[model samples]
Target: MTDTSTDRFDFALLQSSNERTERRNRRLLSWLLGLVLLAAASIVALVLYLQTFEREEAERQRVADGQWLERMVRFHLRRLEEDLLALAYHARERQTRQGSVTDLPAPDPLRGGTLYHQPDVLLQHGWVPWDSSAAPMAKALRADAALDPENAAALAVMQDTARGLRRPSYAGPLLDAQGQRTDRLWLSVPLFERGLFVGTYVASLSLDQALKAAVPAWFMQNHRLERVDDQVVWANDETPSPRPRDGSYYAQLELPGTQIALYVDALKTRTPWLPRLFFGVALLFLLGMLGAVLALWRDIVKRQRVERELQAQVALRQAMENAVTTGLRAWDMEGRLLYVNPSFCRLVGYSAQELVGRSAPLPYWPANQSDELELVHRELMAQGTEAQGVEVQFQHRNGYLIDVLVHEAPLRNAEGEALGWMSSVLDISERKRAERLAQQQQEQLESLGRLVVVGEVASTLAHELNQPLGALSGFANGLLNRLQGGRIGLDEMPPVVDRMAKLADKAGRIIQRVNAFARRREMTREPLELRSYLLRVLKPTQRERQVRWQWDLGRIEAWVDADPGLLEHAVRNVSSNAVEWAMRATQGSDRAPTVRVALVRSPQQQSVAEVGISVGDSGPGVSDAQREHIFSAFHSGKEGGMGMGLAICRSVIEAHHGRIEVGIDPVLGGACFILWLPLVAPVTT
Candidate 1:
């Protein structure tokens, strides 16, 4: 009976212990499953976060690409406008003296070169006269079909607008000569003569070809540029798209006469998903045994990566701030310096600690300029807007003034409230010194030019007056000899006296001309008859020397606007130079001293109704080595020469808006100097 009771009690105790142990095992299994589920959820969340980051990066790249495309479009448009302006300048320089636009010549560079005659992009380019009834001034340099009726009408409108506006105008995306669809752009630049509108210079360009020529090759590798319109498609790569979709950007630009939309498509880029995939696989492989440990390790690694990224960004910012040459600073409204970059401290010859947090009456401000700078600073602070760039001087730590251009903008907080002032300081001391040096050099050159003129006039005056004075003395002596010997009648005496009076008059005129030239007065141009002007220049030389003179003029009846005194000086200098050289040659050889003066017209293309004055000598011809430096100041080929004769002549001719060139005379077999002057209309008043 005792054994049965003990076994029952022990069985009950064993059953209760089993029940407790089973419950504890079930709870442990449930907790393990829950932890595994939580680890899976965390992994999923990390993957989603990575995907979001990639999407944001792609969007940022797209925005950057859009801005780049806009800049490219603007750059191309500016280039086109510049090319058009260059063409217009060429036309203006080559216009006719009569200001007639009936028949215009092409620029010298375009006459034979295929670049302008038949450019790949240009269909036609020529001038259109003011007369609406007349055809284009010149035939198309490039081969193309005749203009269609629609194109002609478009050209008419452009011409009229250019005439009315007195400026350049644009037209067309019209059909080509074949009447096929094409992107043809027509531009017209007005031709003006003395501020009078004369005609239009027309040009036709292929838009497709232009784009191909202008777009850079490197840009094409990463992005496909396309032209978008309502109905048509054009692209720099020649492959067109109806519209751009994902990973693409669009930029709109307004050209001379039309609007264009540019679409840039980004090339495909591989995303870095393999690393994320590998991480997930590793996490799953370690889940059961080291899940908790791996989770803690992952959190530590992520935190480290984030901190390293922040460190890298900070390093980049510091490098950027140090790399900039422009000094940067920040200040509060009360004029306390809040921050100073390394560049700013270096600029003022101070350390960051010495400058930052410094208040008004700052150490760098010069004592004498302190009040002025204070006033300017006060004005800038009171304006309540970003200040324009203001140039100011600062006293460096070395006690010397440093020129700096300061630009200030308002620094704003996250809520857009003005927090302080941000300043950019650029050291412009070198630039300012250069400008002052340039100004001083210019003034010196002007003074030197005046001195050169005075010296030339003085030398010429002495040389010129000697001839008339000697002639007069000889005439008076001869007359006295005849009168004392009673060998001449009253009639002969009258002729001798008249000759003596003329010599005196010639001497007086020489003095007057020299005085006029020496004064360096403003040039006064008047209509001068070409033939009479040449005769006056010949008179002085004829009286001085015994060289045979030959006149080779052809229908010379034109008038040119000239400073009469200076023109006479130039002609006299060149003719006398020829006479002197010719006489020198005659001393050693059998060749008779001869100087030929010719008046003729320049070539039609080279000058429009411009007259040429040629003075040739029968002397040793100029060598090629001497031709280049002959016209330069203080350069001479002759021994004992001051070398200012040709220089002075050039200055005179250029003052009259003409040009002079020296070369070997083909006709006379000697050195020749030709002066070309535009023939002006006779002054009515």
Candidate 2:
């Protein structure tokens, strides 16, 4: 009985131990299954989060790209509008000058040059008269317009709008009869004459060609650009691809005085599966949490670095702005000053605090010039920019005026919207002062040169007066001797007195000629026939010298307006020099001393004709080296010459709006002098 009881106890104890082992096993399996389920749920959640992040990132990138493309398209379109406006301006100028619009030459921008790069983009461009007259070119353009009636109507509306607004206007991405968009667009720039609508400058553009021209290749690599309607449907001929609907970006391209809606579809890209696969295989949550922390830390570090770089850039820009010498100023459209740089403050002799936010008639504006400055400010606000800067005087704080050159340009934003005007002010007081000094110096030098000319001509004047005075003295002495000796009768007294009177008149005329040349006084000019004038001037020279005289005058009847006394002096000087040189050349040779005089008329195209007075002498020819300074003041080649003969002749001729030149005479084989005077209307009978 004791043995059987012990066996029962052992069996019961072994069963109890097995039951505990099975319970522990079931608990362990339950915990293992729960852990596996939790890991799977975490991985699924991470994948969903990554997909959402990727979609968000792609959408953001698309938006940014679309904005950039829209800006680029608008920029090019603005450039096109500017080119068209320039053409219109030129056409208006032509019409104003030529009184017709059809006379315009072929448009340069239409010629497929680098100015927009894409060839054959401009289909047609011409000036369309408001009257719709039957001009051949205008008629052909109208016929082309009639080919597409709907587009023509749209273009006409755009033109009317442009005329009313006095600005450029854009019309369709044209449509076909089936209501589908065609590859054509229109632009019109209005023409106005004295505020009257006269015509419009029209242009036809190929939409596809313009797109190809304006959109860059790099941007097209990742995007397909398309014109979209109100419903975001493609309006172009290109068929849509099966891209993700979520990856599209839309923007409105606001051009100058117009708007175009555009959309870009991001190209389909294969989803990368490698990272997802790696994340699944390396499924330890601790590793993922550590990676997240590391990524956050790196992102913080990157942001800090970027912030430091941005700060550095800002500091650099500030330093550059401060270092520049050209003063910078900004104004709003209302003429209110917005900003003034340090240089501008220094230039105006006022601090930035004193100038900023002030409008026209501000502190730096001269009190006397306020009205003019205000007017200029209004004009700048109206005209935006004047390429040839404005030169104005600004008063300094110390009551001195400063001359400043201000170059204005329209201030615009990234959207090409004009804000106001930005001006670059340059202090030109020193330069202006230097220019004034140079002008004064030039005037002083001119005065000194005139005085020197007078000094040089004094000797010639004395010599001229000596002969006439000596003749008068001889006549007076003879008359006195005759009267004192009682050998003169009353009848003989008349001849002697008449001779004395003529001598005195000659002396008076000589003195008058000298005074006229020396003072350079305003001349009293009259019509003088060249043939008669030449004859009169040469008679005395011929009488004084025994040289042979050849005359080529008496046929040409050219007339010149001239002061008789001054003209006679110039002619006499030239003839006298010719006679003297001819006599000298014949001294050692058997050749006869000869002087030739001629008058010829030279006609000019669309200008007053000139009359030439040529005097040739049989003397040694002028050398090339002597030609340069031959007419300069105090320059002479003869012994005992005052050197003012030719110089005085040149000055007198130039004062009469004529010129004198010297050259070798082809016929005489000697020096020749020619005086060119403007031919005038013939004297009436």
Worst 10 residues of 2 by lDDT: 8-17
Q: Write one digit per residue (lDDT tens) for candidate 2, span 402-449.
A: 998988899999999999989999999999999999999999999999
lDDT score for candidate 1 against the true structure: 0.74
TM of each candidate vs. truth: 0.37, 0.45
| Residue pairs that clash (backbone atoms under 3 angstroms), model 2 | none
Residue 522 local lDDT, model 2: 83
Which candidate wins on TM-score? Answer: 2
Task: Score residue 537 of candidate 1 by CA lDDT.
Answer: 66
Q: Write candidate 1's Cα lDDT for 1-685 as tens digits.
A: 3567655322222221235545665575567666767777777777787788778777787778768767765676455544555666666555544354545565555233222333466766655555543535334412222457766665567667778877666666666677765677776777777888766667777766666655566666777777765456677767766666766777675554555567777676436566567656757654643565555456655555555566666776788899898999988888788998888888889998988888877889999999998898886666533445888899899999999998888888999998888889999999999999999999999899888777777766656676689889999898889889999999778888998999998788778766765675677787888887898768868877888888887664878989887788789889989998999888967778999998878777864678989999998878998888998756777786767678778878887788999888877789999998998876554
TM-score, candidate 1, is: 0.37
lDDT per model vs. reference? 0.74, 0.76
